[model samples]
Target: MTSLPEDPSSPIGESARDTAVRRLQEAFSEGHISHEELDGRLHWALTAKTHGELVAALAALPAEKAGTTSTIAAAGGQIRRRGAWQVPRTLKVASAFGRVRLDLSRAVIEHPVIDIELQLGTGRAHITVPRDAIVDLEGLHTGWKDLRYKTRRSSRPGGPTIRISGMVGFGRLKVRHARR
Candidate 1:
């Protein structure tokens, strides 16, 4: 095993601390830890001066699941997911003549990359992702209208990536980054 540097101010120590913090965030998003516990552990992880202290901040967390998939389908009604909802690793959405809205600005996203597959028969589908999120719409096919998405520079490096795929027949797909 590679030994981490003792001084937290060192580059190696900072990198180790960052990794620990990401793990803690993932644990919280996976429901392995409460918000309070995550906050406490994050404090320790950021302030730790030694490798042992950093390890202690990540103690007892359950192993991350390999991957989880969730499906949402609607025949004639709207499908919406917003506000602090837990985002799985893979999501499948199917709708027919119904609007689909996914607001992920305030969502709890654990995985570094999330895949969303959409199969819409008709109607418009809108998605609002986090400001730092990177979106890929290359795999999406629209029949009637063009996909509405404006590309911009990501504010933060190593942020979550949202990969959207599948087909939309006679419907429009609009994707935008969150303002707040």
Candidate 2:
């Protein structure tokens, strides 16, 4: 409710939050963040109390670069991808003695097909997707690991597909589709 006055002289004016929101939108357009991510950030930007808070909202965004992949490296901890997250065309997830969960139930899919590369070192990865999503687990080459898929739907035209690939070392990989 409290917004700073518009000052033309200052580069950072009352529209700082608005600019931040715009940047977030751009990120979405470029397939950087999902609708849920955008919604969460836009809410924060709109409710930001100060210029710093607005800037902080934008700072949460990952650096935008062509052919770049989003990464989640969890070491001795847990990394989660749920809610509103802008998923990348190619994502790299590495976990060492930890848990990595990716929930695509409400994710915004910019690309028709998504590739996920995982490196689990005695860790666990759990992925959940929407019922309409097509999951392909053939790319995953495992060695001394456990990979499970609970997908009921096959790949079809005009539907999003998630292609999971990568290595699992004494770890667990489970992919489940959400029920409507």
Candidate 3:
């Protein structure tokens, strides 16, 4: 068992703490821990004093395995990934003067989290996920672009997490909620 710091007030740098939180989120998204378990550990991690304390929060989770990726090119009219098709752990979407849409409300997903890379130029991308799923748009670059989503819904734990990246220029990217 990892021991707590001798001094609780000792500063645990924000970067280190952020890394720990990311690790915890990864574990949660990989189905290694339940939402309740993640919530409990997240509280502990947030109040931790040392790196060891943060590491302990993820020590009990299962190890992750390799995942597959899928790429969708939208140079044509439109690209859609809806219905009963399988969903990859990572998705790459590239659109140039076209439209790309991914509806995950009814898609088959094996993983608890998905990583997406988008490249849009004079094009548009639309994504719809289940209401419970969390959408992380932190890595997206919206310079000279338009990004929109449903702000009325609140994301809850236990559902899949979608971490999005990439950039858009003279294009639009939007996210929405869907029920299936």
Q: Each candidate: how many clashes?
A: 0, 4, 0
| Candidate 1 lDDT over residue span 16-117, tens digit each | 777788678777755689999999999998888777777678889876465578999999889999999999998999999999999999999988778899
| Best model number under lDDT | 1
Rank list by TM-score: 3, 1, 2
Collision pairs in model 2: 33-86, 34-86, 36-84, 37-84
- Please list the residue runs of candidate 1 whose C-alpha ends up more than 4 Å from where it truly belongs after superposition: 1-67
Candidate 2 regions off by >4 Å?
A: 1-68, 153-157
Error of 1 at 52 (Å): 38
State the RMSD for candidate 2.
12.3
**lDDT (Cα, tens digit) per residue for candidate 3, span 25-144:** 777766677899889988988988766676676677655454567888867688878888888888898988888888988888778888889888887888998778888899999968
Model 1 TM: 0.64
The model with the greatest TM-score is: 3
State the TM-score for model 3: 0.65
Candidate 2 minimal-lDDT segment of 10 residues: 1-10
Each candidate: what lDDT? 0.86, 0.77, 0.78
